[model samples]
Target: MRPTAAAFRPLTHRITTGAAITHVHNSSVPQARGILTLKDHVYFAKATARGRGRSGAVKSNGDCPLELKMATPKIIGGTGDGHNPEQLFGMGYASCFLGSLQLMASRMDKKHVAEDAKVHPNVFLGHPDDPTLEGFGLRVEITVEGCEDDDVITAAHEYCAYSRMLKHGANVRVTKA
Candidate 1:
């Protein structure tokens, strides 16, 4: 069974209580019960899918870059003409990680070193080793170009939200609509 949000806390978080106000966007707001998070975001987006499974299409609710036509790979009995979820995940991870790496390098006084950093992410889908879970599982390997310093990389990993989520796990829930 999936653990409830109230019961599951990240290993890195220390729970806080009470109406402690935080300044965000020049406004004071009460801290959430479990932990303070980005309830208010600088950017927001929504996507919806249409049509059959992997053969479907996905588009953003508002202005978006592309209206994707998804297709399963030939190895899985698909036409393989279009994109897949793995590709999307890799793109998001790479972009986010690259931004983090660049920021890290700048903070470390090595701005020139990672000015052209590129994050390459390899996302692999395979059967889960855990028996209770479903068949599909994902693993990722990220390589950063233009900077190879372990300290910079380590700092970036810590600062990056995507990196933290991959390493520490996340709370997700699905409900029937």
Candidate 2:
């Protein structure tokens, strides 16, 4: 026997306010709150890192454990075993920016723009000359390939989440190659 719509209705009532509800057929609930909520959707990602800076390791809690060996260069007085944080950030940003390009392309009805697009995110860590300021800062250069028209590329960059997030914080530049 299959469950009826009424059977599932009660289960949704227990959901807390502001929490994402996976399924809600009754439109009145959202209207009453005067708020828009993501329906039938939830996204989550988790990871844990250990050890010293640059020379540490990280693991994700997904079905497949993603173990990463992190290390620094000999110039920094450390063994360059695997990869550094900047490289990892660049890799992740590149992939995410590519997805952002696809998203913008679809929204703008220019899906062809992203068909063969490639994103190269270059992450650089540098120290400030000012002695008062401690630690280092990052500079990013994102190179896009397989697409022309600088205006369209700029539009896509404006729509990219990574670009938006880092724009105010880092020296981020997007260019065509």
Candidate 3:
């Protein structure tokens, strides 16, 4: 049987590492329910960044020494020493969207939709000269491969968290390839 929220006790489990700690709250309250299994539910990733705007570096709180250097392309007069924010965003979104796609496919009994699937998220940064407009904007094109039908891909896209988050706020297009 599936474990409901009422079956669990209301407690917060704190996992700490070095200077970072993440609190996982297990609630029995019926109203505060989450769409996840009992054991594996909440997930978190923490990272800190320092330096100038496009020339900064970020490191995760994990034991492994994971660091990233931020830089813009030389076309924009940047040194292009490392990846920029747009690339990182694309990577994160694509990976997350692929997970969502796989989950949705499994749930819908369409396992082949996600088998050996690949997601390509193309993120573009644009700056308008209009003073009234914001500093910059992003346009994303998410292309999915190994999916048989566009309808299935669209359904998965609709269920993706990144797609939901950027649906109304950003200009995003999803295509099946």
Candidate 4:
């Protein structure tokens, strides 16, 4: 049985890393609520260093805010209409795969000979009738220059976590083709 609101004390948990930084979250309150109270300097710094949103994500106060979409970049096509969520999904998946590969390489202490690695990730959306989001496929082709066969293979195997997150048995079929 779940605890009643009257019984809830709004427990707080703090995560501190060796006098460097501290993060606190209340499980009962919404994540957005009291978020401003946190001294999120380190979090902001990390995001900024990674070239992520610096100002911070703005919240929508409206009941139904206007749906704004970014024009798709010229490289992917679609008249630079960023409105297509599919294009965004494709880009996200491709970038995620490459990131995972790089992370794996770093963990293995394998140095990349080339500065940049190429990863082509293809994302296919299922028919609208398939509300389960089934049959959504992703194909990633990686071409890393100056990397030996052993390191490349190890990276590939280590990066399988991305595919593992897909809905179980929803056909996240991967092929080297």
Best by TM-score: 1
Model 4 root mean square deviation, Cα atoms: 18.9
**What is the full ranking by lDDT, best candidate first?**
1, 3, 2, 4
Q: Is candidate 3 or candidate 4 better by lDDT?
A: 3
For model 4, how does the per-residue alpha-carbon lDDT over 136-159 read when each residue is reduced to its tens digit? Answer: 334232333334444443444334
For lDDT, candidate 2 versus 4, the one ahead is 2
lDDT of 2 by residue, 77-164 (tens): 7898777878887788788878877777777788887789888866767775557778776666667777664545656665555555
Error of 1 at 106 (Å): 0.8
Worst 10 residues of 2 by lDDT: 1-10
lDDT of 4 at 76: 46
Weakest ten-residue segment in model 3 by summed lDDT: 1-10
Off by over 4 Å in 2: 1-42, 168-177
lDDT of 3: 0.61
* lDDT, candidate 1, at 170: 49
Q: How high a TM-score does candidate 2 get?
A: 0.66
Model 1, C-alpha of 122: deviation from truth (Å) = 0.4
User: In candidate 1, residue 90 scores what lDDT?
Assistant: 81
Give each model's whole-structure lDDT. Answer: 0.63, 0.59, 0.61, 0.37
